[model samples]
Target: MQSQPVLLTAGPRHELPVTWQLSGHARRLVSVAVAGLLIAVITRRPEFVGLAAPALLLLLPGRGRQPDHLGIEIATPAGQVTEGSQAAVGVRISGQGAGQVRLRLHPGNWISLAGESPGEDGWFNFRFVPGRWGARQLGTLEVVIFDRWRLAACRVLTSLPPVICYPEPARLGSLVVLSKLPARLGEHTSRRPGEGVEFAGVREFVPGDRQRRINWPATTRRGTLQLNTFTAERAQTTVILMDISVDVGAAGRSSADLAVRAAAGTAAAYLAARDRVGLISYGKHLRWIAPAAGRRQAERISYLIAAGAGPPYPLEMLGSLAGDILPPGALVIVFSPLLTLRLIESLRALRERGFAAVVVDVLTAQPGTGHGRYRATADLARRIWRMEQEAIRFSLREIGIPVVHWDGQSALDEPLAPFTRRQVVSR
Candidate 1:
């Protein structure tokens, strides 16, 4: 027995505005024509009344009905992608009476998708470019199917899959400039010790001595011992302290975005160098991720940066950070614009605590001209801004904490060179 094939489909839903029924240009035109025809009929012009009937019919709200049911299915690539890479996302729409519907996707910024009509089903494919790395809640797809004559418009909201875009990790060499600094702990020693690569001591070769570390010439000459020694490689912990304070003027760039990128870049570099990495973000509230090693730590930090914005919790929060955020004995790298007094105080406090704190200032190089009724006011503001920055730099230097100022215009590595040099010398 042959079986009939069943089709998978959805019904059309209506989203027409109530006023669309009798309160538009069409309605106005109908009222005018009806009045004119009634006047003619009173004037004994019966033929004119018949002519008006046709016009009245045209003015009546058209019989376009909303779709009975509607559904939108979105398709996207699995997992997260590095920044700048493109991902494919498709939306499939199905419903009865969807043929003449006009559909639009919301949040056109996040994903780039085009709308299409595939017979009874409407489909769209999007090429998404994630501006920054993190989990993004791409809101629902909005389908607006209107009645005939465009009088009434019906809207359908369908949930779409959420997408996460991970921050792009910079290459090792690109971030090596930052790593030129000596490891905070376990640095290689110049002189060889017991169980090391360099030749530390040569005694008569013990029976159990491995041939690999044996000095044959020494063994022959001394008739006693030969062995090589090497120092053990040490690992250090790097804590990236990001200032998310709204007061930190990023100039044109968003303070939050700049902080996130800096944290990501710095953390990735530390992890790649076999150093443990930790993150602490302070703004209105504090967010901390304990120090750890490996790719997973980097991922965890990236997720935090991506998902975070503005003040941490309380909206009215202000000032710099409290002392409880950082792990003891970790090298703290603070990335901030240093625009506020509170932030400066916080950095100073960290340095006081014996933490090797380095400040990466993300301030603007060019302060553009301001517009206002008072040129004097603009000039004063500029002067105040410059003075504040200089004071912050001076304060940090006095405390022996190096401040590497990064003007958003140039590569971070160049400005970081001096700090790296200092770190090497200090180590």
Candidate 2:
């Protein structure tokens, strides 16, 4: 694999006075002064020439040029992490031919090297705590260097590799009661369809039953009886549908971030339960990855989410869906802030296609408007928007689709329980 490019920054440096020789203004001023001085001496006006020459010299044009250089190397963390874990990052900077190079970092999260002079080689070590499970681009590093005289400048750009932060698997005790599901779904059984390790019942021998499942002892116990027991085991396919529309902007936070967290959490949960998981991101553009199982799929999805919001690629929902963006019979869970009409229509269409669709509404409660004419109007507009959102929710339910409203303020399970309960009953 090709190595990442190393970035270099040079601080301001003192160059030889040759920089003055390159100035046209300086040469012109010197020539004019020389001619005036010669005329003054020939005319026998030494005192008058002395005053004029010094003033003329002051008007001479001259400029100074300083040299500066800078270099930066950054080390990023590895993929994957446990809840409450932290990742370490290292940044090194060196200056050449430059006076003290001052640095400014964007995104503010990165800490600077301690006790190091701005112009000298220094090392900065810092840690980032990825609190929630999901994929994330830690942030950007903005480096600025200046010359000793603070005149000339340059810049560099670099993108850190994506990181996958998996959710801590739900503990057994915390898992919703799967009691409604047949006990067979819980145990390991033969790889055959509808048979799991959890005993379901015994029936006359079937052609597909493994000889190991043949209850020979039971056969002898019951004269002339040959039978096999079966259990329940099936793999589910889960599709995470995320909304990247601009309308989700109502909530002070970007809808994209919440959508990523929800998608990541749900995907991780389903994967842990041995289900096939896929992802589809809808905005101005459609991003789709087919259903697959295992760690790599999770990594792929996380990387996409970490890249953050981009201009939506223009495309119709049906066109994308028909093009294999989502598989038939996949349980499609949408994480959106309920911003646009297009998103609502898309969800309705997905349900019409017979997909088990769920919507996790990421709600953001706006702060109360302060006293002002403009504030009053804004508050009224917010009320209208909320009403519209409720109507959308009602419309979705009318079409037999379940909606889960989620706000980052609370635990995810709070909103999830109701929807999951309804799902069991609907099944």
Candidate 3:
């Protein structure tokens, strides 16, 4: 990894001279000074003394001493938290004597901050819930200092620091059943005999056979040497394809969140099986990690899944990435809302090329239905749309693509168990 650049802040050698500016109180004071002078000179009124006295009193307070020694710094621990988890952040005000500090925090769009402003002390602590994944940004913090009279004030916003948020995969037990795994050096048993725990059969002891494997009972019955054989355990390659073409479902949140969470859970489960896992984020931009086995590969895949997708592009481009981007013989599991035609065509293209493709349908029902006037027409249109969707799903299943509809909160074991059993039996 490349080294990160250091940031230069305004402190110590890079410190700036303390400065103060006229507040809104100064503006009001000027109006009062003008009115007092106008009343005395124009009307020769003695009552102007009261107005002039108050203006002088307010202006005199500012002249004596204005607080300028104020600086803001943010103190946060260097660590990580999962999405939807809350993290405590602190903002400390340094070099006081600047009257009462009224702090207002803005923790950006990625985090949901829930806490009051600063108390009597100069410290501000808040619990913020992380909504987006990967390198969460804590927004700008604004502090407005009020003088003793609450009239004059100074407003300053502290700069945001570097904060990285890591993606947290869902907790899945040993119930996640995947498709039939290909033959490789791994945990799953292979058809042919090799070195494994499962008993295969017995054969005449060869020169390379271990003596411990010479089945004594069988050798005694046949009066010959025989060696036990075990099936070789092999792992398969699984690739997660995330389709982020269009985000149109909920009001406050988009469908991308559900898609990402599902992808993360699936990746974690397959990697736990000691299989080679890879990832490909398809949308306006294409990001992919090739298949590999190890702890680092799993972490890399998880990071890419949570690293928010790029802007939307034309969907036609995705159909062209058959053999060029992804390697052959890797099972492709796509998580998508299936809102566009180009996305459908892209999946079809992948299957046409002989890749074992599966689609996790993340698209749920629309929130609200139609109103009074266009009610009948809207209902008819919706019925037709649903019918078309059913046909599309059936077509995919017929072509050997398992279309799994994900319940946002349930375990995926039930849906995947059939797929796993079917593939294993076929193999």
TM-scores for the candidates: 0.68, 0.61, 0.77
Measured with C-alpha atoms, the lDDT of residue 276 in candidate 2 is: 71
Tens digits of per-residue lDDT, candidate 3, 352-387, equal: 776777788877656366899988888888888888
Each model's lDDT comes to 0.60, 0.57, 0.68
> How much is the lDDT of residue 347 in candidate 2?
79
Looking at candidate 3, the ten consecutive residues that score lowest on lDDT are 6-15
- The reply for model 3, stretches above 4 Å from the true place, is 1-61, 64-71, 75-77, 95-100, 116-124, 132-137, 147-151, 158-168, 174-184, 201-204, 217-226, 251-254, 308-325, 421-427
Ranking 1 against 3 by lDDT, winner = 3
Q: Give the higher-TM-score candidate: 1 or 3.
A: 3
How many clashes does the backbone of model 2 have?
A: 24
- Models, CA RMSD each: 7.9, 9.6, 6.0
- Put the candidates in TM-score order, highest first: 3, 1, 2
Stretches of model 1 off by over 4 angstroms after superposition: 1-69, 72-78, 81-90, 97-99, 106-122, 126-142, 146-153, 156-209, 215-226, 247-252, 309-325, 365-373, 376-381, 419-427
User: Where does the lowest 10-residue lDDT sum fall in candidate 1?
Assistant: 1-10
The digit string of per-residue lDDT tens for model 2 on 172-285 reads 211222212322233223234465556666666767667777778778877655666654565556688877665344422446556766777777777777667788877667
Top-TM-score structure, candidate number? 3
